[model samples]
Target: MSPAAAPRVSVRLPGHRQMALGLARQRLAIGILVFIAFTGLLGFRLIELSLFDGPVQRARPAVANPNIRAEIVDRNGVTLASSFEAYALAARPRDIMGNKEALIAALIRILPERPPEAIRSAIYHDGKFRYITRRILPEQAEAIRRLGEPGLTLEREAERLYPHVGLAAHLVGYTGIDGRGEGGIERAFEQRLTDPAQLEKPLALALDVRVQQALESELKAQMDLQQASGAAGVVMDVHSGEVLALASLPAFDSNRPGGLVGMPSHMNRATLGVYELGSTFKAFTIAMAMDTGVLPRMDERFPTTPIAVGRQRISDSHPKGYPLTVPETLIYSSNVATAKMAERMGRQRQEAFLRQLGMMDRAPGELLETGRPLTPAPNNWGLASVLTIGFGHGIAVTPLHLATAYSALVNGGIYRPATFLKVPEGAERPGRRVFQESTSHALNGMLRLAVLDGTGRQADADGYRVGGKTGTAEKVLEHGRGYDKRRNITTFAGAFPMDNPRYVVIAMVDDPTVGSRMAGSVAGPVFKKVVNRIAPVLGVAPDTSGASEPDIRMFEGLYKPRDPKRDPNAMRRAAAGLPPLEGGVR
Candidate 1:
């Protein structure tokens, strides 16, 4: 109140001064609002960068997420296929700031795999951007970064790695440039591998790494020894239909799949390459006869003399001048007897039996590379077709098909589709019945006899009670010039511990040049070696006493003992520049 009284006599402030004061106040208020808005915008930008924008996104290139692809492992947790973070070298040609020559030199030094001229040409290409390389190592990226080239940018990317390399290449497959699976297991389970829910869970295959290694090594060794054009093999659990090992040659590396496009070596012969798997089918014919009661007695006899069907004359490779019993027919691998068995079954019944055994369709399994069986059309399937198919010549199928069929035949007549997944213990899959249990048992005994005294003598492992059949089919000449007498596709399909069948193995060699070229000579040894190597790893204890062997006394006097001097494998050993076998026919 005292101050108001003192100012009462004074005049009011000038209008310009009052206006200046109002303007100052307004300016102060506007400054605070501007400051607050700027602060909010800066905070929002920081949050967006921190949460959504990182090195991968800022690179502005398509990059695969390593975490998206689930690791692939064997049943024992041995890593087969995996994915990892890597770097790619990309360029913005228009944005070049450093010396072009220097940059090119640096790139050449960093990546010796890339051609020097390629780098130079890429830099000079008329384009806004280019990828110098993709899936480069971190060390390479760092080396290139030291060049300080403004045009060059290193991008984070996902690289699919096959730690085992070509070990299980065909089974694990490979991812494409975009990181999507393209073949094998990778393609078969693309959805599962890429699913977010399953990313953390590894895909465990039925394959045992040790078993697979042994199989591949032995198969490859045989292929090299025989100088064969190609080879295929399969090891499967007879009871559960689980494929423990599948191999094909010449094998390509999974890590370097880029060069494998359209190459025959890239083919998965185990599942994709079809061949006339010769005498392996004889087992099926004999089993069919037994199951249908067409041949009720094991001693039922048929002439081994060459038989004529239409215009085709079928003869055994090593002909016997006399008739052979049903069991002896399989033991000697006589085509004439097998043909007669099919003739008795009739074409209709033979076709029906094969259909039930899955010989009329593609092999059922987890592989997308499975080949459809090549069989005579129903309308064209005549008696001749039946006879030849019975001997395994008229029908073409993958090695996997024979393996699966053999598994069914030996696994107590149950037919289960082959699988690559690790089945839980004590939880076997349900299967359909393909043969009577008695029929299977009888066939097992006859096959054991074959290994003991006939064509598969070389296929026996010391303590495994190995039993198998050998097949030798002439390859049709290029351009359909009829079958070539010199070139053969030889195969051996068999099971071990025949008394309680556990595994089926199929091995095939195409056009072997260095051996006798017969299945017993070329392919039988592969089976023997594989069984001996993998049996111990698979927990199959050796039975040195033959206590667990199948009884073959049913054919006691039905056939003559095989002569050691006539062994087909003798010619193979001689041709390979090796000494003759000291223990012949073993």
Candidate 2:
């Protein structure tokens, strides 16, 4: 056929057929445009997911970032626990483009702590993704990125950090592998700390770092000096019930809590370990006697003879053989006299007062590690229980329990629950009245007299008007055989600037093997040292002029100052350059 000249093949159609053919061509064009548009969209999405977002991020929705935690700070705004941005080494084995052996060696060099087998498995993982190591340092992340392997990647993550490692470990607590709080205030406030709406807000505790440091340092020093197995200390605001400092010996580092697993260091002795705090309870007994109107006068006398109730005989550690006045009974720490007072109040009145003081229940606070007090079962509480528990035996309560009770006894008799959260300045938490204001006033003088002429003399910091009670209770034998005489827990619970009590401080030492092993010599000195350091920090000014001394006129003629020469241990203590013990182990 000739090219264009001979070939003129054309066909004509009717109007309806022509219309149909044109419509078909238009529909075909539109379908091609739509397919092209859909193909472009799919390609763009693949690039966005693989290149921009990265595979690591694609899997992040399944895992929560541990660093999404709020900081924890002391009352003074000092950082205690915080979260910091860190990097994690991850891998996508299917996308590996480098020598697997070389990559494994490089990773092993970067993170020696990670097992070589783990690294190799992660690189050759038969899965979409795997995590090689988390919480990697920036330098290490940079090193890994320098390897330039397509499969290897660094993912953004977060890590918890405690700057002052063991400062308040038992109180601040540590996080677990899943970034959740496990103990102390951490577990107590886990919800608030991890809430997405409150992530940026810090958890401010009532602890003052200065006070905490001083308390922990002094307690540790005394624990070591006394050759004691353990120690615990607490400093709380008398009026506000805010715990300024709480220390438990053998503290573990919050940053690495696993190092001391199975050891007693992790136990918060101040809050979680309960003990029968001996003669310190005498203060409560005396107050109870006065509050219940059982004793009309502080000068009323109680015979110091041993009293027998059931099979148990109650005697004084330092018995003043002659008849002694009420003031004399406490000054002497006479168990017989204290038991006699308890006999007058009876068990019902005693239990009621203790319940009012929060002694019959678990110590109330923010911490989850709080100890449940071990008291005699209500059905089994008998005369023996009454007599012994009167002077802090039979019933076991935490040091925090005693601290909170002591605060009530001295702080105008208001029983406020102890708190770790910072109470705003000029604000006071409402409290229940446990003792009459007049009774509290009387206790202030009695406690002062105790420090001046009784078993707590070693605790008196000059000019600080420190007034507290000494407790030296024999520990109960394991399995409840009997109290061990050779082993005792020494404690001193008191408040400073007694004329107008501001803070209550308690120090306890477990099983001291050094010196006298008495509360006066062991725990008393601890209280004294802690007071000397914290009084000024807590805004309690020193007044050595006796101007701030409580009015102790009612107790003036009740007892006489011990003639140092008459003290049996005076000669030995002076020879050893130690303070004279007024009533050893009472």
- TM-scores of the candidates are 0.85, 0.82
TM-score of 2: 0.82
Candidate 1, run of 10 with poorest lDDT: 54-63
Expressed as tens digits, the lDDT of each residue in 302-372 for candidate 1 is 99888787789999989978888988899999999999998889888888877877877887788798888
Give the C-alpha lDDT of model 2.
Answer: 0.86
Q: Encode model 2's per-residue lDDT on 1-586: one tens digit a residue.
A: 6676786778765697889989999999999999999999999999876764444333322324544788999999999999988887888888898789988998999898899999999998887678887788888889888888998878786678999999989899998755778888888988788877788889899999999999999888988887889999999999999999899988988988875666989889999999989999999998998999999987778888888887888888887688888877777798988888998999999999999999988987999998998988989898898889889999899999999999999999999999999999999799999899999988887787788888988888988888899999999999896899999999999997888899999999999998898999999988999999988887888865555567665554567767534232343345456675445321
Using lDDT, give the best candidate's number.
2
> Where does model 2 exceed 4 Å of error?
1-66, 90-105, 112-133, 149-153, 259-261, 563-586
Find the 10 residues in a row with the least total lDDT in model 2: 55-64
Q: What is the lDDT of residue 413 in candidate 2?
A: 94
Measured by TM-score, the strongest candidate is 1
